[model samples]
Target: SLQRALWVRNVTGCKNIHLSSKLLLEDFPTDFLRAVTCQVCDHLLADPVQSPCRHLFCRTCILKYIRALGQRCPLCTFPCAPSDLVTPAKAFLGVLQSLLLRCPREDCREAVRLESFGSHCRGHQEADEEGDGGQGQTFNSYLPVNKGG
Candidate 1:
């Protein structure tokens, strides 16, 4: 029930799918990674947010950095506080959402767009629950064929 497990992990609104994993994003070129990558965690930005000084980091990462590591932006040393977080540009979100990413589970190989990954995982999760782990696969090879009819 790997699919089920993956679905459970993603119950939150956050992109817990680990889109930064190389298995999920390995197909992307290095240049593309630069645009979406969070320097603090070396992961594709999740809930990507910015500091008042405009450096980007994953929302969780920046909060952790400020709480435990330091009070300044890790990249630019600008004074940073939890309230300083801001939404990144809509144009940047567009690029991030468009990237084709793979499933985070070790078992799944479905490559999906960032925007669609949740539904993709949900389909397999539902199938696994339906006593038809094979259901998500639309080929329906198990059905009897009308041979020579």
Candidate 2:
């Protein structure tokens, strides 16, 4: 639950965020996952970057991978460097944000849109701090799912 709450700060690329791959909807196409997921961590992208080889990876993942492994693309083995990683197009990032993911807290089974997940997660933290223990309160994002994109 703490991790979920902290993910809100991840939007600024200030920290590492980990959302379980299991939270992803099973109906989403595999091709979509391949494009959006970090090949190193196999989780939803967080501050994602595109390699010169055209493969996508979470900015943190690629940095750690190259530091631990080598200066090569993890997916294609193409020579890559920290400079080779670039922020992806805003339109592409929006698609990743629109992907719906189920809430990870065991007590909360609500499905929330990725774009709204920050507020949804914060609701849980706030409710807990208010002594609700995330029991009776519903942490609904109320933000419409961005389906048009």
Candidate 3:
């Protein structure tokens, strides 16, 4: 069943892969597609991570999603327990990492390193939120901070 579904998905690129056809070669249902698709980017699953509810998203994408929305599964709104979110299998991770790209942040200017990509993204987001342009500041210039004694 999984192989057939995957074959169907691959043949149609998930755009028109249907579930109800007697031939089973038509487009998949929207709900099924949504169930399998990544909510963060609305694309086909990369390193698909199955939530407790069985909804899947790209591993990295969903982690980023969780970071933005807190620890909740987007599909069923179930609490995504910290321990439940596991890194995808090494094989899947390799495939997904090869296909994924880094965010086009000029300051980041770094390739998406596989093992540390998630950390890099989180750091980048935090840095962006903190409004610190360390790249713009000169290393030799020392700014005094007022620490109240």
Best by lDDT: 2
Candidate 2 residue 37 Cα shift, in angstroms, is: 1.0
- Residues 55-132, model 3: lDDT tens digits: 666566556566666888966899885457664567654643443334345555565533344455556655655776
The clash numbers for all candidates, in the given order, read 0, 0, 6
RMSD of each: 12.5, 8.6, 16.2
Q: Give the TM-score of candidate 3.
A: 0.37
TM-score of 1: 0.65
TM-score of each: 0.65, 0.71, 0.37
Compose the digit string of candidate 1's lDDT tens values, residues 34-134. Answer: 76877566566767888888888777667766776568997888899888788899998898777777565457777787767656766666766687565
**Model 2: what TM-score?**
0.71
Ranking of models by lDDT:
2, 1, 3
The reply for model 2, stretches above 4 Å from the true place, is 1-16, 106-108, 132-149
Better of 2 and 3 by TM-score: 2
